[model samples]
Target: MKLAMKYVILYVNDFEQSMRFYRDILGLPVKMEAGTYVEFDTGATTLSINTRESVNELLGLGLTADVPAASSFEVGFVVEDVAAVIEELRGQQVPIVREPVTKPWGQTVAYITDPDGHFIEICTAVG
Candidate 1:
């Protein structure tokens, strides 16, 4: 089977806050938005955010627990300079999970968490 469209839907606790983090802070263009649902154009893939209440209603299941506490999954953004991005994020008061550092594979990488506590990585390849 072949895929026509790819999207990563994140269930966020606060819809507006998450939207601001992606749309305003990250500067991703909004592809579409309807009430509590928002989709951002992330080049090849789409990143969407939906309220947890909407997700529970759609699934017909009631989940009162907080957002999932998992760090194994992350959305990565490729940038030209990791340090410059980190500095910008710092100015925006975004939480920095890890400082920009060169990895063993010759790539500079940094980590930050979104409003929903989802991991986001900013990276750049080094020669």
Candidate 2:
């Protein structure tokens, strides 16, 4: 079987705040917005945001009373300066899960959880 990842949907509590983070702060290019859904162009893949209930229903996970605090997957993005990114996020008063730190994989990584508590990693690979 051949499978390709066309989209990554994130569950967000506040749509506008999440959209602002993904669009303005993260700098992902917005493709379209319809009601509660917003799509972004993420180079080879697409990023989307929708309500938790809708996502759960689509995944066949039954109806969930509330969205989980965190996602099972860690979404990563390469960055030039993980530290700078952390600083910028801090300046904006964004919640920081883990401060900029070097990982065992030789990457300067910074981790943060989105409004819905999905983990996001910003890292710079060390050669």
Candidate 3:
């Protein structure tokens, strides 16, 4: 089967707080929003956020009670300058998991945690 579109859904404990963080703080354009869901248009793939309650109801399971560890995975974004972006995020009082550092493979990366403690990596390729 072929995929027509792709999306990453993040189940958040607080819908409104996640929405504000992605839309206002990260500055992602809203694709659609409802009471318990919000989708951001990220050009190629969609990034969606949903309330844990909504997901639990949909799956008929207690997944909300089994929140994964923060460092299990991370959402990444490619930026022109990891250092500059990190500085901006710091100014906004965003929690920084790690300061920007250049990797041996010629890339700079920084890590930050979202409201729900999800890892977010801001990185740029080095020349």
Candidate 4:
């Protein structure tokens, strides 16, 4: 079967903090916002955030925001300039874990984390 990805939902601990980071700092437009869940309009695949309590209530699974030390996956955004984005984030008092760097393949990339510790990658388009 052919599968298409629909959304990436982050079960965040602090809903308000994560919302500000995504909506204000990262500057993603809100597509939909309910009391417990918020979805951002990010192309075909929607980037969303929800509360931990809702996940357990809906899925019946004890989901928590206790992320691992090492990130298993990252939500990446393709931007015009990685350095510019990093600078903007810095000015907002957001702690950037990694500065922009050019890889051997010639793509500039940087790293930052959201309030709930989800790795966010800011990079230029792939060659």
Candidate 5:
């Protein structure tokens, strides 16, 4: 049997700030929310955010969102215009990890980190 993915959740330090980032900044609609957990509608899979403190208390794993290193994975978004989205994000004082650049494969991409230090890639569809 093959395993199927359901939802992706990022345990964040500040729940309100992260909700603002995805809800207001990135323009993702909220699909569901309960307590400190939230799920965003991405038109495909659901992207979720929750408090690290809650997860730790529930699982006893002692997870922390304070790591200084980059995570091994990134959440990517395909947009119509890379530069326009980047400009909008910059206006909200979000720090850009990389300016929009066209890759050799013909996709214009830029990078930014979420409130939880998760890498978010905004790019144009590959042509």
Candidate 6:
């Protein structure tokens, strides 16, 4: 079986803020934008942001805009230098959930949480 991940959807409170953060700060290029939705091209995958209420209405659920704890789900990015990325993120005032640490698997990683509390892991494999 061949499986591939296509996109990741983030339910956000303010689409504009999230869009700016992802596009301007994080440097992801915008692919599409509608009234309350924006999509960014992240190499092979896409990152989409939608209003919380819109998501709930589309899914027919009662999902709220309350950001959950950091342990919910993590987005990992393979970086050339995890430390450098972490430093840049810090300079941008992005919340750093965890400082850079070397894992037992011989990888260096740092964790950051987005405005909605979603975890993002910046990592570099030991060579």
lDDT of each: 0.88, 0.81, 0.87, 0.89, 0.89, 0.83
Please state every model's RMSD to the true fold in angstroms.
2.0, 2.5, 2.0, 1.5, 1.5, 1.9
TM-score of each: 0.89, 0.82, 0.90, 0.93, 0.92, 0.88
The residue-by-residue lDDT of candidate 5 on 18-110, one tens digit each, is: 999999999999999998999999977899988889989888878777765337789999999999999999999998999999999999999
**Candidate 4 on 1-127: residue-level lDDT in tens?**
9999999998888889989999998889999999889999989999999988888899987776574632777999999989988999999988798999999999999999888778899999999
Worst 10 residues of 2 by lDDT: 61-70
Q: 1-127 in candidate 3: lDDT tens per residue?
A: 9878589888888888888889999999999988798899887989899878998888866766357855588888889989999999999999999999989998999999989999999999557
Residue-level lDDT of model 2, residues 1-127, one tens digit each, is 9999888877776788889888887888989998778999987888899865666666765544364646678888888989988898888777898898887878898888776778998889667
Runs in model 6 with CA error above 4 Å? 67-70, 125-127
Better-scoring candidate (TM-score), 5 or 6: 5
Best by lDDT: 5
**Residue 7, candidate 3: how far off, in angstroms?**
0.7
* Preferred candidate (TM-score higher): 2 or 4: 4
Error of 3 at 55 (Å): 0.7
The worst-scoring run of ten residues by lDDT in candidate 1 lies at 63-72
Give every collision pair in model 6: none
lDDT of 6 by residue, 19-117 (tens): 878888788899998878888888798888888888787787676766563358888878888989999999999999899999988899999977777
- For the record, the alpha-carbon RMSD of candidate 2 to the native fold, in angstroms, is 2.5
**Over the stretch 52-85, how does candidate 1's per-residue lDDT look in tens digits?**
7988988966644464753559988999989999
Off-target runs (Cα >4 Å) in candidate 1 are: 1-5, 125-127
Best-performing candidate as measured by TM-score = 4
List ranges where model 4 is wrong by over 4 Å: 67-70
lDDT of 3 at 74: 89
